[model samples]
Target: MGSKLGYVYRVLKLGGSLITNKNVPFSFNEELVTNVVNVIKNFKVILVHGGGSFGHYEASLSKENTQTRTVIAMQELNLKILKIFNKENIPVFPLPGRYFTINQVLEILQNNLIPIIYGDILPNGNIISGDDITLTIAKHFHTEALFATDVEGIIINNTAVSLLKSLDDFREIRTSQFDVTGGIREKLRKIFQYKVNSLIFDGRNPTNIYYALSGKRIGTFVEAE
Candidate 1:
C-alpha cells in the first residue's frame, strides 16, 4: 500500500443504488448498509458513498435551490451511515466531499480514523459523483479500491467480465432515472483515466463486501493497464 500510515489500505466506494432504493425517493437500504458497515469495521480504508435515492431524488425534482437541497439530502444519508459505523464502535469521521483535502484525509488515517465522504453538489452547483471522489482519493494514495455497487459488475450481453481491459469493452447499461451524476459509464471513464486498478462488485450480498475488501477476487477487476 502507498499509505505512509503503513497498513493494508484502500478506498471503498459504496454505490448509492446499493445503499438505497433509487426507484423510491429517500428510501434507505438500512439492512444492507448495516451489514456492510459491520463487515468493514475491521478494515482501515477511506469510504465514499453516492447520492442514490437521497441526493439524486432531490436533485431531480428541485429546480430552485438545487445545490442546497442536494447537499442536504446527501448529508442526511451520510449521517445515517455514520450512525451505523458508530454503533459498531468504528471510529468514523464525516468529511465533506466538496472541500476535503488530501492532507486532512491523511491526518485522519494517521490517527486511525475512518473518514467517510459522499458525493455532493459543489458551491458552483456541479454534481460530483462518488466514483469520481473514490478515484481521486485512490490516485493520491496510490492504491486500488473496491467499488461496491448493486450490480455484480460491468455487464455486457448479460454477463459480467472478470477483467475489464479497456473502455471499449463497455456497453450501455441501465442507470437509475434519478441519478444526477453519470453512472457506470462515468465510473469506467474515471477508472481508466486514473489507471487505478479497482474491483466493481455486487454489494447486495453482504459476504461480497467482505470478499472484495479482503482482496479475495469476488468480482470484476478493472485493470490499470
Candidate 2:
C-alpha cells in the first residue's frame, strides 16, 4: 500500500453476491455497488461480474435450454449492472458473450474504457463462466485481476485461505467445492497457466477492493507457479 494509486489499469470482476440479495427480484445493492465504485473511480478499470442468483439460478431451475436461457438471463442481468454504472457515471460498456474474447478485452484496455462483462453461456453453446473471463483477461493483459466474491477467499477449515503466499496448501482441497459453475478455484487453475497476478476477496467488503487494486494485501492472492 505505497501510495494507494499508481496502477495504470484495473480489471474488477464483481461477484453475484455483491449485486443481488440471495435470489429473486432484479435490483442493485445500492450501498455495495456505490462503495465499490467510489474506491476505484480514480483508476481505469474493466468490470466483470458473475451471474450470481440472477441468470444462473433461474436457468438452472427452468426447463429451458441451458445455453439459450442463460444467454437471455445474462443479458438482462448485464443491463441491470449497466443501469447502476450509468447512474454513477462510470461509463460502462456491456459486452455480453457474443462480444467476449481475449482480443476484445485487450482492445478495451487499450482504449481505456471500463468494460462491464458477466459470466454467461457463450453463443457457441459453451458456458463461459466469470472466472473463465477473469483468467482470460488476466492472461492477455498482465494487469491485476480482482475477484470480489461472496466468500472472503479460498476457504479451508472454515476459514479464509491464502494460496498466494502458500500455493501448495490448496492442492489437497477438492475442486468441486471451489467450482461455482466457474469459481475461485477455476480462476486459480486457469491463472496458473499464465503469469498474471490475481486476487480473491470478499465482495461484501468494498474497502478490500480498494486495497486490492492499490496493490495492498487485502485478499487471497493467486499466482502461477
lDDT of 1 by residue, 1-225 (tens): 656677767789999889999889999998889899988887777999989999989988858998889889999999999999988888988887886778878887888899898888888888877887898888887778789988998897899988898888588778788877777887888889888999999999989988888877777999974
TM-score of each: 0.95, 0.80
Measured over all alpha carbons after superposition, the RMSD of each candidate to the real structure, in angstroms, is 1.3, 4.4
Q: Model 2, clash count?
A: 0
lDDT of each: 0.86, 0.68
User: How good is model 2 by TM-score?
Assistant: 0.80
Q: Relative to the unseen true structure, what is the C-alpha lDDT of residue 16 in candidate 2, on a scale of 0 to 100?
A: 73
lDDT of 2 by residue, 1-225 (tens): 111234456678887766765355445576787777777677667778887666656556547576777777778878876776678887767777556886676565556567777887755666667777776665555676788876778776667767664445564343222223744455666667655677888878777887777777666777653
